[model samples]
Target: MTDHLILRPSGEFAGPVDEHTLVLGIETSCDETAAALVLGGYDVASSVVSTQVDIHAQYGGVVPEIASRAHLDMLNPIIARAIVEAGVPDSRIDAIACTIGPGLIGALLVGVSAAKSLALAWDVPFIGVHHHEAHLYAAFLEDPTLEFPLVVLLVSGGHTMLIEMQDHGRYKLLGRTIDDAAGEAFDKVARFLGLGYPGGPAIDREAVHGNPEAIHFPRAMMHEGLDVSFSGLKTSVMNHVRKHPDVSSEDVAASFQAAVVDVLVTKARRAAQQVGAKGLVLAGGVAANSLLREQFLDACVVDGIHGFLPSREMCTDNAAMIAAAGWHRLRSDGPTSLDCGAFPNLKIPGLT
Candidate 1:
């Protein structure tokens, strides 16, 4: 269990092997128990996500203990299903990968433990993937031909940061949230607005029918470099609701979303321009936001920079992205040590 395997001279493991590589990726980072089969980094044979959204919806957020237990219960079956759907024999898997950090501790352990065990059983290399880094890799899975010099904005419930990608596995963080991340702000505000759990989708749907200019919510740090702030905006929304009890919820939602999108897009574009990036990318869970996606693309057009975003499935937490990142890691850095431990607060490389 203490041995670290290298994939450089590997026959079937991830690398520039004679044939394509197959990786089984497991992810139990939060409320989703996911497993996937990815071929040659970009081709997804099958991906299965058993979401606990309904179970966590009652609480308006994920409970780490509950998420961990659910992962333990569902992971085996999910992995099995991915293999079955991919029509690949268990022994044919070239490598095993799993998200190892920057998530709920217990939730991360399930995936890590499973991945380690599978690698041992299958006698293949194990790759421990960083959660946020994998999100950036999701864009590559959709289009493997993406060029370097990319300005990537990673926005999610737990993190918000802008990174400059010089190349695969090379990143330099430009800025990040000083307080609450964009997703956390969305969840808190959505709860205050009685929009139910998983606030991003709730607020997005409501905003569709409402006027984005109805409230003119504050856009924090619009001119303050690439770092973002949303706590003030969240508080403002709550205070507004208290004062104007009769205010339209749809209007509130629209106004709040507009504030977020404006800040993210403006900052992202600025970063891209500063770095002279060839492409701009939106990643992480919150990138799935409709307004963010639409506005981001529109801004990219205006800025004359190439834009990249993965499908909604890849935007949120998933094992497929983990596998895709894993393949790249194995190819470039070889394999991870078996003694590697799960890190709940694993920051991406070049974290500011």
Candidate 2:
């Protein structure tokens, strides 16, 4: 395969060309190999994702090496498909964006390398997007009118935190997990119960048939600051399973999920109040949890705050959100240097 793939712009479709710039986004932060063409940043033209769920299912969790290899194999085809579906030629892409950090280094490099190669070939701007920041911007993709000075709850497999967003690229971290993230805890607890890989969904489905209050799982840091601790909770679930061998897995899943939701919702509510936020935004993989979304919305209503939740598709790893964030960054700061490399612990620059 050639290092650069080229396509001619199709002139047949007479869409509104001057209204928005078309950007191609790539994301391989973890197990999902994704590419998307976004219009004016917010409007998704086409999004293609190749998931490694089945590949990692047997292992009960993602294997970093396998994920990176899968991205290398699938990234090209996915990008081609996104371009085709968008009906936009490669030459029409105004800029290219890729997630640069706070993820598996191997997986991130595959995307970053591809993005840099494409930018060089197309002679277009290359924007490096932070993984977590893209999650926050996912809400903006659906709600373009969403105002700033909002409280963002970012809960994924690797991260769990509350951020006060004052403006685009300006963030103040309010709280974070001291140990395992909410999703990580779910996966660990799911394994303890033999629930299977991708614990979040498995637990969610089973919890529907079980009693959330049947077992009392601890909700750490509930009365303290914005920080959370799920390691203790995970251990509690393990001890419960070990002591009560006959305890129903469904009840364990329900109770564990409830505990996590309780902490997340409480912290988000408190952060919003403290910051006087105009709205509360939920993003990242854990935000896809049914219980969490329901509880968050209810909490928002009780606290008299507007709640913004991206669709399930947007909640998970994807390139569209990266494109949306990159669009704004490109406009404000231009493109990053071609020498920019992947950052495993990349944080928003202005955030503390």
Candidate 3:
């Protein structure tokens, strides 16, 4: 356990708790159990994330049961750590927010249950957040100057979508993956090439030395407006590896990334043009890939569209992003009741 204890006043605290709302945000959407305390406005007081990567690493991916069990074990400690680090007593927390959907049902329940419990115990408001929407709002935490009417490319292990954001609450679904998500393709291809788990970063690292043009790979749906597909591409990679069993892994990684990047950038460029968006923001765990970042920036430069990405550490699962997302929810509606249940297949509120 990480120590973050802080002393506080005994009777009356210095300032009004309502004047400065501190929100406790919890996220257990997948394999990470995260908690963060964010002050009213934009300050992140404390963030704690307990990962189940090692436990899931051997399985090549997250096991829903294992993830839920791990979250059950870490949820309380993670929340306690956030509160301690924030130097705020439980009474100071104005609201509780949690990732409520678009993830494993069991995993989502852990965070939702914890948030509901805290809200009930403290008589505070409870707010539910969508995981992918939270990813888009992550930009707010890193870049306060970021405004709306932008295009968001949300790429993750389970999702690949293009969203046009008109404002804080309004969204237009431009396109989405027709098959496997980009991150899922990366993981599957990496496994095929004998690379280990959590494949995006590993593939990106290997692609640096290998030539992306080494093998000719198909860029799917390049002419099909903004919709994308990676299943055909993943199958192509599998077939290539089977035909050439002795091919170099580095070359395979490069070729795979090249194909993915080509499709992603192509679609993003089209989305920017179609929607006339001024900015292009990349969100989700796969956005951490250095190659994707580089390729998207290059595409944005050619298209004269600004590209934005969160810090690499924020790309994966974390509560800081969730807290930032919760800020929007709290600002709009205040809080929620304890009966808010976790939703497994939730999409972006408006996009669905």
Candidate 4:
């Protein structure tokens, strides 16, 4: 994995894209501190991610203050490792990219500030990447030449939504969760079930040996258009557990996982068909869930649409996706102003 850029005119830059310039990416969106060097938009030279699971696991979930301070310590070293692993000096990096929005404010700043400092030092363009937008772009890293007009299902710890990508940086928000995000619900349900921290993985593992049909979990808002709601289902899980003291944790987990997966795949597929999409891309942290991934891909095949999924590592938050998205943004819109600051609630571009 070599990081080399050909200094050529724009007219002369057209050709195979596997040998593209190197972009440094930083991500501190939540509990993960990550950095990477990506070639072009799709070729990943090196990606480094530091997960804060052990620190937050004792607390049930991520604590904002702890998350930020951790990022401050982890960000720089991770960046250095990625640069070293990619076999490139900081001076040779062509651009810098960082997740700048829709994440913990303090955590987001750790990455954005580092990017600005690096850009100034290296004299490279600074690109700010939207967190959710980058999740969608993870699919491109797996295969950059994928057909457009694909619907992306981004299901993370804090967010879950269906977006139609008409093209790069252009999107149509089809639907979103009305209350708790899928991953959030997973955490809550898992905690109540004594399944432990980071619910998605916990529930996924337990549900494997359990019977999904053992319990009749409610699938909320199934016929109510594309928008989804998991709050009701979560409540139902709590109520059931409270009422049935002897309830099997595995059964509850399997049933709960089934409900969430059913809603997600159904809504995503319907949204794709509504927009005449050519493919369906499952992304974000929750995309790493076993059931959701299996059902999503099966649904896409049944519907006759291609399915695109990043590796489990890429499915979760990582700088490689941010770097990949940043590379495209740098090429399409030039550099973002260095004065731009972190936006914890920054909306995805082209959405109301």
Candidate 5:
């Protein structure tokens, strides 16, 4: 548990919340039950995540009912640990932030209910955060000086999209997945290859020792504007495995990973060039992929664009980024009413 606690204090709090203004962030948007104490917006006092990987591993993916139940059981302890680890009293927190959408509604409700209750009990504001928006804010958590006019590639198990961020709270959707997301495709292909659950890491580890070009996997959406298609690529992998019963899993994994990386890099770079973006930011679970990270950095260098990525810990679902984004929203727009509800398809406003 201690190993999962990423407590990095950024010296001092500087954003909307200061040392005196602390914010508690709760995130139960998915299989992870997370809580964080953030001073100001970027300064993380303590961040704790109770992952349901073990529970969901057998099922090959997250079961919404199981995930929600686990969150119900783990959220209180996680939140308590975060506050205790941060050395702050409940009364010290000025606001409570919770992920409110673009995720499993049952899981989201647990966090939102807790956050609203905490806010009411503590007499503080309650802020509802967009899950994907919070992922974008993760980049800012590590790099406070990172600027806007950037392109953000949000790739995760559930989402894949290229967003043009001109300023805070402003976004333009450039492209998205027509069917399966990149990470989802990775998981499905890994399952077809007889790899274990949570395929990203497993495939990544195996790909390290295999030949990426041994099997030529198709790269989707090379010329289809910014939007990508991964369903065909996944089907291709499945077909290859079925036809070549004796094919090496390592080679397939490497080839598949390479295909995904190639398409992601091409589209991301295209989006950046189209918008004349000064920086490129990658966020979400798939952003933690080693190959993706290396390839993204290489592309940024080739294009003379700055690249921003959060620490591996921040790349996944965590509440610190939610708090960071929420702090800004709280200061700028005030708190959300208790009537606000969770939204599974909550789209980030201003995106087309």
Candidate 6:
């Protein structure tokens, strides 16, 4: 494993002097075009995210081609606005950070290209941030008390993973979704139930009026290891909908949400206990789901573990988290090679 820490020049005065790093982060991996500036470790100096939901809502989901095009249009201005809001010039930024992978190919390229260009122009180091790593770091921004060797549950549109955060910039992947990320399942199920686009929040909103136990949905891998599998459960919900032609959609939505929460929280709790983690972190867009938040918090309370969650705004795809992560990476090591490019399938080095 490559070292991430960078040694600073010795000061005339002994002891440790505070080293502050500023990072400008760009995230265009999916539907939202985001940019942010972070200072030191946790302070979000500025954050700007441009949503393309209005354009994608008609289709009930994001279209990759359209999303890529939309990113191209909004990215430049979004980045500029973030810098303006941060009240800092490009020259002051210590490093550039961008999400490079595990997202739409074209969408990932827009941010990567912009980041590379900016790094070149500014003569700063470029750092590539893993999409999921940013999610875990989101917790640090919200709760500085969070410690290492903790379990991090990342629930999002394109990913559902359980990671062990051994230390800063170090991770161990414990488990992940076998098929269909949690939020992806939410979107597909919502569309199947005639709910609008951006399924997680939409479905979460509609589930309030229905009975969670109205339908008995299967919880996949509930009795097994921490690994999760939601695809079969999603199919089961579809089957339920088919069998009950007269059933209310509200019940279907509620039942479906219940099943998902059951498996998600249950597995998360299991992972936390198995690892004897000191802290539990929840992140990603699906982490914004009210039911999941409530259930996970409740479980943590019962299990006697510290639970950390990002502010609702930080739960989704955002550059603030990336900037926060990048600042840490920068302090550890200067930055990535200026020639760094996009990695659509970028992995957290040695994580798995």
**Which candidate comes out best when scored by TM-score?**
1
lDDT by residue for model 5 (150-178), tens: 89999999999999989887899999999
Residue 9 in model 4: shift from native, Å?
A: 20
What would the per-residue lDDT of candidate 2 be over residues 1-352, giving only the tens digit for each residue? Answer: 1111111122222333333888899999999999998988789999898899999999989999999999999999999999999997788998898998878999999999999899899888788888888898899999988887899999999899999999987899999999998899989988888889898998999899999999998888799999999999999999998999999888989999999999999999989998999999999999999999999999989988889988999999999999988887776666777777788877675586
On TM-score, the stronger of 1 and 4 is 1
Candidate 3 C-alpha lDDT tens digits along 191-235: 877788888877988788888888888888788888899999989
Q: What is the lDDT for 104 in model 2? A: 93
lDDT, model 4, position 344: 83
Each candidate: how many clashes? 0, 0, 0, 0, 1, 3
lDDT of 6 by residue, 32-61 (tens): 999998887688899999999899999888
Give RMSD to native, each candidate.
Answer: 2.8, 5.7, 6.6, 5.4, 6.3, 3.9
Which parts of model 4 have CA positions greater than 4 angstroms off? 1-19
Taking all chains together, each candidate's TM-score versus the true structure is 0.94, 0.94, 0.92, 0.94, 0.94, 0.93
Q: Tell me the spans in candidate 2 whose CA falls farther than 4 Å from its real position.
A: 1-19
Candidate 6 residues lying further than 4 Å off, grouped into runs, are 1-19
Give the alpha carbon lDDT tens digit for every residue of 48-135 in model 1.
9999999999989999999999999999999999999999888889989899887899999989988989998878888888888889
Q: Candidate 6, after superposition: displacement of residue 48 in Å?
A: 0.6
Q: Candidate 2 vs candidate 6: which has greater lDDT?
A: 2
lDDT order, best first, reads 2, 1, 4, 5, 6, 3
lDDT of each: 0.88, 0.88, 0.82, 0.87, 0.87, 0.84
Candidate 6, residue 3: Cα displacement in angstroms equals: 16
> Which candidate, 3 or 6, has the higher TM-score?
6
